[model samples]
Target: MQQQTSNQATRRGPLAGVKVLEFAGIGPGPFCGMLLADMGAEVILLERAGGTFASQLFGGGRKAVANRGKQSLCIDLKHPDSKALVNRLIGQVDVLIEGYRPGVMERLGFGPADCLAVNPRLVYGRMTGWGQHGPLAQRAGHDANYAAISGALDTGRRHGGAPWAPPTLVGDMGGGGLLLAWGIACALFEAQRSGQGQVIDAAMCEGAALLAHGLFNLNAIGAWDGRCALDTSAPFYDVYPCADGEWLTVCPLEPQFYAAFVERLGLAGDPDFAGQQYDTARWPAQKARLTELFGTRERAYWLEVFADTDDCVWPVLSMDEAPQHPHNRARDSFVEVAGIVQPAPAPKLSRTPGQVQGEPPLQGEHSRAQLLALGLSPAEVDGLAAAGVIRCAG
Candidate 1:
């Protein structure tokens, strides 16, 4: 694939001409910006004048995958001249994203009401752990907190085991960032017809809850208890450690698939394993038997055993092992950028597939050029940089 730069004119996706201004932040905010940038939006990351908590934490700004495909402009929102500078830029951009507490943007004078006054067609997307207006909206929280409060984390726990969710993936990226991006896209679409933009309140807690809708429906219908066929309590739909310490995921929910699984294991004649798939009363003993049976073989042995079967058993590859998997390699599921291996753009479109526009940028790396494009004179830009209202990197 040909490498593409962050130049807007050279972008080639469905969002090629869309303009987005992101108030730089950690977690979901940056992730949402990266999503839009990957879709060929002209995303201008308005970073803090000095640095961001993410930059300090990661220490390698150029390798931060979430910051890819963006031009950075570092500005002090607290500076007296900042409001005018930002409002001017807002007039030109189609979307504005910020992930701060409810009142922080209002305090900075760039709130939805404020920015919409300058540009009525601007889509203002606000991301938070709670929401813009709620009892816990102003409270401090993180991904785990959001997942826990939204009931998403609890549902994933085993019958007696404590709930544990993968950090960021459950709440931040899946709920907060991705949901906000979809909301922004919907709002942008509506704006094209109405010629008016609106604000999107994207809360991680709410997003997490939305993500668990299917589970919620099942639970409400009494079809799913704490221990069901879908959960790990069942022997057929669970992960087990092999003799080699590697793991395999075994899931055969359908009757035909279950037949294939038991037949492959040479247990088709055994009454203990040949019964109905959803025989809940026998799950515990069956799970124990399968555990012992799987432990007798290496993961590679099972992989070869089920390679051509519809038994739905496969290896659970680690992060380092995933990129080299045959299916992932065939699909180009990962890409290398500046010696760093990361996931490629997803949900491929046949005509205008998304691309990684460029490498991650440093704070203020494009400040001078972006500011000049906003119609600021070079002298004024230099003066603002000297006054510490803006930062310019070499």
Candidate 2:
């Protein structure tokens, strides 16, 4: 891969010279691509000739934040010529990411075996909900199903009621995309030393289980009951509503922090509140007192009261409000590109800063250009386009 310098001082990121091929898919795959692209990798997104419906919805026509910093190529994998073109590009790519149920890539002839044959140093990343092999692997499943099997969903339920869907964050982003990205990075690091590549099977179930490692340890130590409400320590972590009905999250786990929290809440003078911070027998009463005190003031008032204190209190900001928060704004955590508001590149590097290069491409936007860049002649590119193997964007 060739290193390309960006015009701005802050645009040349750590992964500037890396070349990645993203087999365009929904959810986790695009997210992983976005992460890599944010860090300055040259990512080429390979879409099918007709384009998947997901591409139309999420891959904003020249404006998708997730699709930023990537070029698109449309090809029919079923065609031998298209496969040959992909194989040729594979030889030049450092990493390949795909999110498909077990055998889909194999059927398309772009499986790890075929990719590694083309480039021995290619890091092939596979992301799926149930994984590559299992009784449920071939079965239809989504983020919820995978989290359910991994024991994460059960932990989110209150007391004995039905499990609450804790959004798709746990399964899709944390488990699927982040895990696959980590695996690819690790594999790339190892490939540098070994001079060979390997396949990364990043299953959502496995990643979800990994996320619950701390809880699992607590369970093993008899310090935790999976029952949500029964765990007195959990009340401290719960979100409470204020007088205005807005929510505030309070989490003061340390003894000193708890004492400070009690002091800040005017509960320090109560004898009943003393030495009851960790006592399960007193949690219900403590929680009740806290709730009652919290109800006396609006969320904004309480936020002001705890502004300079160590009570570990914070207002629960909504998604739209989060980007505008003082802290987020100060950190430059969000950016607006092409009229779309989204999160900025994360994990800041002092010397090499990341950036969102450009908007997502329209379907098959770079098919001809990418093929020509790969050293294919115009006649050959025209022949492939005529045979319905490749489509170029106008």
Worst 10 residues of 1 by lDDT: 1-10
lDDT of 1 by residue, 1-394 (tens): 2233445448878888999999998999999998898888989999886577777775546778888888888998888988899888999999999998989999899988899999999999999999998899889999999999999999777666898778898899999999999999999999999999999999999999999999888889997775677768788888999999999999998999999899999998887876687888888888888999999999999999999888999899998999889898888888876567788887788998888888888778899999999988999999999998899887
User: What are the lDDT scores of the predictions, listed in order?
Assistant: 0.88, 0.81
lDDT of 2 by residue, 138-191 (tens): 887778887888987776665545775566777887888989989988998899
Candidate 2's TM-score reads 0.92
TM-score of 1: 0.97
TM, every model:
0.97, 0.92
